[model samples]
Target: MTMEIGLNLFSVFKELNEDYFGTLEKVAEMGYKNLELITVNFSTCERYTDTFSLPVIMKKFEDLGLKAFSAHEGVAPGSVIIDADWDRIIEENAELGCQSIVFPMAFISGREDTLQTAEHLNLIGKKCKEAGLSFYYHNHAHEFRRIGETSLFDLLAENTDPSLVKFELDLVWVMRGGYDPLTLLEKLGERCDMVHQKDLGMHVNPVNLFTATPQGTNLDTMKIYTEFVKPNDFVNLGTGIVNFQETYQKLRQLGYIRYAIVENEGQLGIKFTSIESDLKVMEKYVQGL
Candidate 1:
């Protein structure tokens, strides 16, 4: 069977104006089958949640036939976790019929603390598993930072129970970090469940992992022409550097038949035109897959 392709809702966060209604509707319009809810940037108290309590939003997803398979939330500010609404997210994800919950690392400090990150995920996974949910990290380039003998991904994967903790691999960031993307995929094994895919043409300047920028390049507004997504050069699917064909081949070889999320992380500004550009290009790709 062909692998499932999805859109990471982060892109919508920009152009949709943080309006949940517009975001959901636009996702359906784009013909996405999967969605990963993100930390809202709205000023509305209920909507601006790192702690989710959005049943109406979840219902809308179901109503529109968008399966919210995963979601992203922060390490409860100050605390390593959402001590208050932790149960709520688990139960709601179960309610919305989502399969996994994704926790994002906001800082290098958080990324470097391998033991704590693993323990946090392991603990959350155990709890969620009981509710028929799984816990995973959404990897960025930072997670690949090496301390001694292994990358943080290695330590967290090793420490977390294979049955519980999984991963949502972000491809551009992984490549930007200077590690072979396939190597991390291979090392991660079954822990791999989701992926962030975008292309970046060859970045001309020195690389910056945190900023996803290269020297000599104006990241705020990148003009595209080539197809060599360099380290830090993420763009819409066909408009940038990644070779989706080869990436898809590798994924098929390794049995990754789940969601391939287009994390068009607002590199410059939130523009729906980029998303439309992606959909137009990726539609052909997804159909072939």
Candidate 2:
């Protein structure tokens, strides 16, 4: 299928609070036809699984004319994925009708940490494959740090099995990592199945591009990581420095057909006017493509 526009529920996590179903309803109403789920509360998952069941949750999405395309497992960095939990994870996502499961981020201190993260990814990716689901690793700016001549991201990509472990490239973070998004996209090629469509507003300081932050930092203190981000650094789709037109063109040329999830992480205390506005921006850009 040709790739379509979707919203990462994380963009509106704070606004929605713990209203998981309410968020889905609001997002669909806002004209987002697809969703990339982020687990804000583990209880929310249990509530759905225990009371409604996976099919019921899927039905809820169907009722609203929305598709749950993918979900972030939302595990913390450096945490081991126990083998026993693999079945539960796979089953939950399968029932949600997710085509892929993504490991959002991993805390890597150095070369050793990077290697350990890669091993964990491969292990999880293997189990995900056994359950008939694609597994992917989502990137942040920290992955751009070099271990030697190659980046940590390159190490993970090189070590993991491409068939089992694809990548979800976050464009904004790619720029923040001091690399051209297009160059990274070219490097990943077919291994890239999804891209996070976040825009960077003007006034970004390239000098602070590679500033590394420790992984698994408290969510409440996330704003500290945005110390380098200007007030307008995070923005909606077409309103910022990211060249969506050229990026989409490259994706098409590369025959990349995967979801483009609009993610506006409200870091630096910066918030978008509304999620609806963000969705509108993406819709207009995708239509033009």
Residue clash pairs of candidate 1? 200-229, 200-233, 200-241, 201-228, 201-229, 202-228, 205-215, 206-215, 229-241
- Give the number of the best model, judged by lDDT: 2
Q: What is the lDDT of candidate 1?
A: 0.67
TM-score of each: 0.81, 0.86
User: For model 2, how does the per-residue alpha-carbon lDDT over 167-213 read when each residue is reduced to its tens digit?
Assistant: 99998788777788888888888788689988776655543254433
Q: Name the runs in model 1 displaced over 4 angstroms.
A: 42-55, 76-78, 82-84, 106-112, 204-233, 267-270
RMSD, every candidate, angstroms: 5.8, 4.0
Model 2, which residues run further than 4 Å from truth? 42-52, 82-84, 206-208, 211-232, 267-273
Residue 174 CA displacement from its true place in model 2, Å = 0.8
Residue 250 Cα positional deviation in candidate 1, in Å, after optimal superposition: 1.1
Angstrom error at residue 174, model 1 = 0.8
Model 1 residue 182 CA deviation in Å: 1.5
Query: TM-score winner among the candidates?
Result: 2
Q: Residue 56 of candidate 1: its Cα lDDT?
A: 70
